[model samples]
Target: MSEPLLEVKDLNIHFFTDEGVVKAADGVDLIIERGKTLCLVGESGCGKSVTSRSFLNIIPSPGKIVSGQMLYRQQLPDGTTTTIDLAALDPKGKDIRRIRGKEISMIFQEPMTSLSMMHTVGDQITETIRLHENVSKQEARDRAIEMLRLVGIPKPARLIDEYPFRLSGGMRQRTMIAMALCCNPTMLIADEPTTALDVTTQAQILDLMLELQQRYNMALLFITHDLGVVAEIADEVAVMYLGKIVERADVDTIFNAPKHPYTQALLHSIPKIAMKREELDPIKGMIPNPYRRPSGCAFHPRCSQVMERCKHITPNVTAIQPDHTVRCLLYEDMPEQVTQKEAMHHD
Candidate 1:
């Protein structure tokens, strides 16, 4: 309701493969309120990573942003509303460099990949702290030590001296978080931060992130395929398919009142011990290739509830509630969707 801390509107990304240009992301629109967590959830290769990367203008070259507007908080004095035309920003511009870590930071999918194996974890965090702030080495080191402790790394004094290869996966991830938080960025983009860890470690990392998010009052863009994880930390959820969002809603509305058929299928696919084995539903089709997306509604080919109109018409997002939206004809008449859906089961 208040001005969003960050706004992503009509974002489209295209990649130049050996074969052809692939549309990795299409028409993505999202709003993040200050201190809220928005989880982008879907199956692997659904553009969650690409969308997150685009925020900081890090989508690999040859893969360019075709269209988009990424606006950061408008109140900053250095710049009014930074509506970065991601496609137009020169690599040498100060805008992105200034925001990269100080205003927005990212925690990559793999901890090992993000961490510098050659540097001591302490040195890395301290360097990041000094890079953004006018602080002495001692001050930076002290801040780094404090961050290590905040992330729950055991023996902060000893662990900060270790290299990435020297620690376990969980500890390595904590080190990554420490580095990311060193600058106290306005927002944090976490892309599958728990993907590589074992379930126990995954739970702990998720818990730690939630705690840190609360402590720092950060706007978090959490990307994960796990609906279960979405249930745990997301204040809001966006269900993405090949290159577009099929549904977006508050956590409870998403879990209990899914409007898009794809969303319903996705939520149903989450394994439940309570569900009968045969009654459990799995979505029928694999993700379509980005280069050869299905015409009209991308989900039409796989959607169980697909109608003839779905094959030729790209569904637009229709608001079903103040906080809920779905890209489906079923939601064409917000009120009728509720009545029609209910009538179908009536005697």
Candidate 2:
């Protein structure tokens, strides 16, 4: 009944390269509620990482958010709530700087690259705490050590003085998690934080994140391409193609009754444990070139259920049931889609 923690509508992010503008995130919509996990799942280049980065107004150079509202329901210290449009703020300004790590923090894909080799792990974590809170050096260092302990790192007091390169892959990632949570952020954006680790370590990191999410009552926007990870940690799943989200639903429906052709194809692509290696059914065609996107539905070129209308008329996002939406011509005739379909056709 309460407003969602974050709501994004028609999020359009583009990269203006000399060759052409790359439509990285075109008309992307997302909603993340408090204390829940929303997994943005798609193959590489589907705009998952870019979309998450936009929350912090950190879209890399040469690419920027062209339009869209990132409405964050910020809880004030006095218990009242205020909505702030993160997309409109200056990326280098103090407002976003204050909120970036304190209210919303991000864990990048690779810890080795994300963590600074020059600084001790403790210094990096303490720096984040000192920046947000009016705390002294000793106080911040103590807090950092406590966070390291909380994230399951052994001998935190000693390891805190060590460089990132000295730690194992899993340990470095745990330190990243500790750093992200040091500020007790309201929401955490993890961009494939576990992809580089082995299966056992990945599972451990996933469990740790879920545990911490519950402990902190923080919303999580996890970006990943692994369906297995999605099944393990996601409450809701959004399937992205190119720059558009083709389907979104609760984890069960996304895996079981996915409506969009692309979603179905993606689900089919997952290798079954008992199935033979040759039986693996990967998606049919390569993703289209971004500079020369196909006409109408971007997936039509490879969509097995493509229709004549798909060649020219883009499909509207249609809700087949409560809390379930799919963008595909096959669902265009659904009663809920009539109005949107008409509008798209008119355009």
Candidate 3:
């Protein structure tokens, strides 16, 4: 197997607020290879977005990565490979800045607020290109126009000069993609990029992103709450709850034979065409507040297959199949004493 482009291990990020510390991300482990897409799926406030933002050290104020190792394999100009621990790098220092746009770029959830309304889209794109590359102004502008065209913007020459406000949601998103890919980064972190678009536009954006990923041979960290999108675009899927990944497996296994109760609930929640009249089986209970996260398993409160130990002890992440892993007591082998205790408790 080829070396992974990026690997995150035991990542923990938190936000210190007046209320309390919010554990936005807890022990997230993920891997993304070149030209492959790893979809991070979870409900709102489940740390999917936070995990992606950590890649570029762009987590908003009051939030900080408490512990983790983000190993990034970078190919230098001389064609030599070096692995750097991104978590240890200074967030706003020169080294990270050099890598952020050139080696890895991100498309945030909302393009309207992400793009500056004061500047022409053309200027923004070209400025990003020039920031990482030592290119002349005209050359940068030409490259920006080419990127706009590449992203399927009509009349790229005219559109480039228009401000972001003038474009529709889809158009703005396309412009964002154009800006992100202009540098030909090795990895792209797209956080719910299609959330605000209509279904048709969402499909178009997904298709466009997939096409661009292939063209550039870049790895993708796609964060979304949409299972349908995961089924359509993801080679691997990681199901998260609260903060930790509850399950990790191939896309087909995730959809067809999910092992974690949380994963099962999420899959069951998806509306089905064959069962048109049936109501969606929404997961019971809400995701617990981060400040007062539930004891033991963070997801025990909502997990349908909760066990006695789930409320008292955290289950270690265990591998069931070759590439599939789950953090649930159901998969663990219980000692005879513990089994007898559980049986007596039930009686």
1-347: candidate 1 lDDT, tens digit per residue: 77788888888998888988877788988888779999999888878888888888888878788887777773466666545454456645787777787778999879876788899998888888887789999999888989999998878988878888999888888889988888887799999998899999899888888888888899999998788899988999998988888899999999989989999999888888677888878899888877788876889888999876566667788989878988997667535455455445432
- State every prediction's TM-score relative to the real structure: 0.91, 0.95, 0.95
Cα lDDT tens digits for candidate 3, 87-147: 9999989999998977999998899656999999999999999999999999999999999
Q: Name model 3 segments beyond 4 Å from true.
A: 274-278, 336-347
lDDT of candidate 3 at residue 213, scale 0 to 100: 97
lDDT of 2 by residue, 1-347 (tens): 56999999999999999999999999999899999999998888989989999999999989999999999999999999999999999999999999998999999889865689999999999999999999999999999999999999999999999999999999999999999999999999999999899999998899999999999999999998889889988999999998999999999999888899888898899987899988999999898888998888899999998876677667788989878998897877745465457547756
Q: Global lDDT of each model? A: 0.84, 0.92, 0.90
Candidate 2: where is the Cα deviation over 4 Å? 334-347
Q: Against the true structure, candidate 2 has what lDDT?
A: 0.92
Q: Which stretches of candidate 1 lie over 4 Å from their true place?
A: 74-88, 274-279, 333-347
